[model samples]
Target: MNTQSYMTSYEILVYTGDKRGAGTDSNVSITLFSKNGKQTGKIPLKNSNNKDPFERKQVDKFCVKGDYIGELTKLHIEHDNSGRSSGWFLDKIVVTDIFDPKTQYVATCNQWLAKDEGDRKISRDLTLHKQQTTTQKSNYYKVTVYTGNKSGAGTNSDVSLTLYGNLGEAGPMKLANQEDNFEPGKKDEFTIECQNVGELNQIFIAHNNKGLSAAWFLDSIVIEDLYAMHTYQFPCHRWLAKNEDDGKIARFLVPQSSTTETPQIRKHNQYKVTVFTGNKSGAGTDADVFITLFGNQGQTGQIKLDNEKDNFETGQKDEFIVECPAVGEINKILIEHNNKGLSSGWFLDRILIEDTQGHRTYEFPCNRWLAKDEDDKQIARYLVPRPKVKNNQYKVTVFTGNKSGAGTDADVFITLFGNQGQTGQIKLDNEKDNFETGQKDEFIVECPAVGEINKILIEHNNKGLSS
Candidate 1:
């Protein structure tokens, strides 16, 4: 007696083919896949083409969503002993998704079983959780056959099981012990090689007599497809930086220029750099801008710059580079007027400064630095307090807010309260102003804090207060 097992949300596909010749038997029973690797749900053969010499049978059992256990676990194909003949045979047996069976079959064939002609079985038994018999030996798998409705009943056949890489090609099956326990309609078992089983992508089971395709009783089958998850890099390019507030560039750019010309100077650690002139504010033409790169003891590297004169746009940016000297010391960068053209009276806007002073070379995070003004004035840094999730839930309390701009008078603070308790304050606003905002915001406190919220008080240094 064979018991079938089933899992949730799975469908079983079974194909049954022709029973021709004098000793053909069309009685085949397919089984469900068992969680224990044993056949479970055994369904009887419903459709048949008795008159046709070539008969192919197929059945589909779909389990309800999340009902994986109802899927087939085991299949039992029994040949009637009373009507048995000498030349009974079985052909290719396949189990797969009704929509896609190719991928499953190919993947299984290449991974699990052997690749031989007379040693491979066209039909597979998915009921087995593990390839218990097939993968037992070091480089070989075994197949055991039983007889009739009885466990150990019936006689063994004199035939052998063959393995194949695909359904078309012959040989290359790489199977051995082909003549071991050959049983047809009776209880029998045998082993096959496992070396060249690389092409078995899916689960397939079937049997054949001699070298030709034959029809035999078959049971249940199951298949699974596996995929590898990994991370890979592809080709991509970086975009040019627009301004200091925009973002930082991953790499520096090289400009085309000659030794006689001077280039625009950029501050260290700054992502954005723009230049403008006061003299020729409108008459756009090539102006001589002398750029000097100095190293230790007045030493210098390459003086690279663009040959084309800059038009000095309000927001446009260009690329230029300074090479480091062999000595590797603090290098001073200066930009002067060589030709002193009409637009030589230009001024720098977004002057980013990079730290090339210390012995250790470490580029600062783009957000940490800003351009300097006439008196070397830098932008003020503001802080924004981030709150943690409250333990006592207040579904009504909303914490939507923002921080003020640098130098702006915005006092940032959070007025948190619970129950009838005094309000707790957390400040994140600038000295000049409290906070910035596009619209209004609110928050709700949980039940435990509800009674303490009524006595809420606002604590802030800068900016105004509102209810």
Candidate 2:
């Protein structure tokens, strides 16, 4: 509950125990204060009058709540034994909303000791071991340390450090040497390259007095491959977007112009629509464009395209990302292009869809349907979280033919069933069922939460089907 809100509640738990001798009774009290140490409230737990060792008493349970924002609060528990011994036991203390746990700060130590306006310190404590024979691999591992002691001469006593590792089965390894050290008031760094005895998981570091004091510590027990993980370049923060215009001019759309050239597509039951106009020709025209997509059965979602509404211009190619305020299964999208007898045409290239985490949309790897839809599956579906953004829906696009693909059209759709009703289905027609050569289809579904969409099923119901 330690939040930025101007008004918040504070909760705490106080335990009290044994404040008497082996034969007398005791008493205890609890007090609460504001972050500035101002007394706010107090409560008495118990008072004893007996004098037996087994007669010593304790406070059962104490709870308190207070409004504390932009300040620190304190709790003081006291025990009084006017006629008995003088030792009190505090079992536990709990504080609520003390600090924001989600704050992103480079941790110098796994357990932060302190951080504030002028000074900060991080530390680690670990143990390393060497081999029993000299025949081992290069008896050493590289230790990299990062510090933020910039603009101040760095000192070691204030930064005590120690290294303990296994030697050739004789004794623990201690400061073989200080590879590099800097004075106080300056940015600091150090590297202790040790003999590789398999791996060194722990490297203990402390500041002040060489290694005597435990004031500052830094430890990184986890070994990570800093170079192997794949890094992705987000084309732009606005990959998937929502606009109320024709559903075209997308990150991946067909290059074309004109409503007569290609029909603009819309979701079956919702406000969502799609306009396809990003052809490889690089001409940002949409006069001859048409769009198509499978509609969910309930028809509660919306879809649209903006081939021209965005900052699209001629002779320039642009990539876009889909944005959704919710999460859902998006399985169909289609678009078409014709001159509408205008004698002018549009063209298109590739299309893709990915999740919020940037992982393209493909069902879970272990999904059973993966094998069945192998021929019509796409590797470019990425998930998005809903309700947090404006357009609370997913996005889709059409590739290949307006309503077809290599062997089957790539339209998408979904099915829904109300909480108390039976199941239903939605199908992406045109390209989804079957499309002309070289066209793509895209669509989206609003999946803000489980309450938004009861169920979703996608299919390519081509015109040739006999339902």
Q: Using TM-score as the measure, which candidate wins?
A: 2
Weakest ten-residue segment in model 1 by summed lDDT? 227-236
Clashes of 2: 140
Task: Compose the digit string of candidate 1's lDDT tens values, residues 334-396.
Answer: 443333344332333332222222212211111221123222333222222122223454333
- The TM-scores, one per candidate, come to 0.20, 0.21
TM-score of 1: 0.20
* lDDT (10s digit) by residue, model 2, range 324-350: 222234445443332223223333332
Off by over 4 Å in 1: 1-6, 18-28, 33-39, 44-75, 78-90, 97-467
Give the CA lDDT, 0 to 100, for residue 188 in model 1: 45
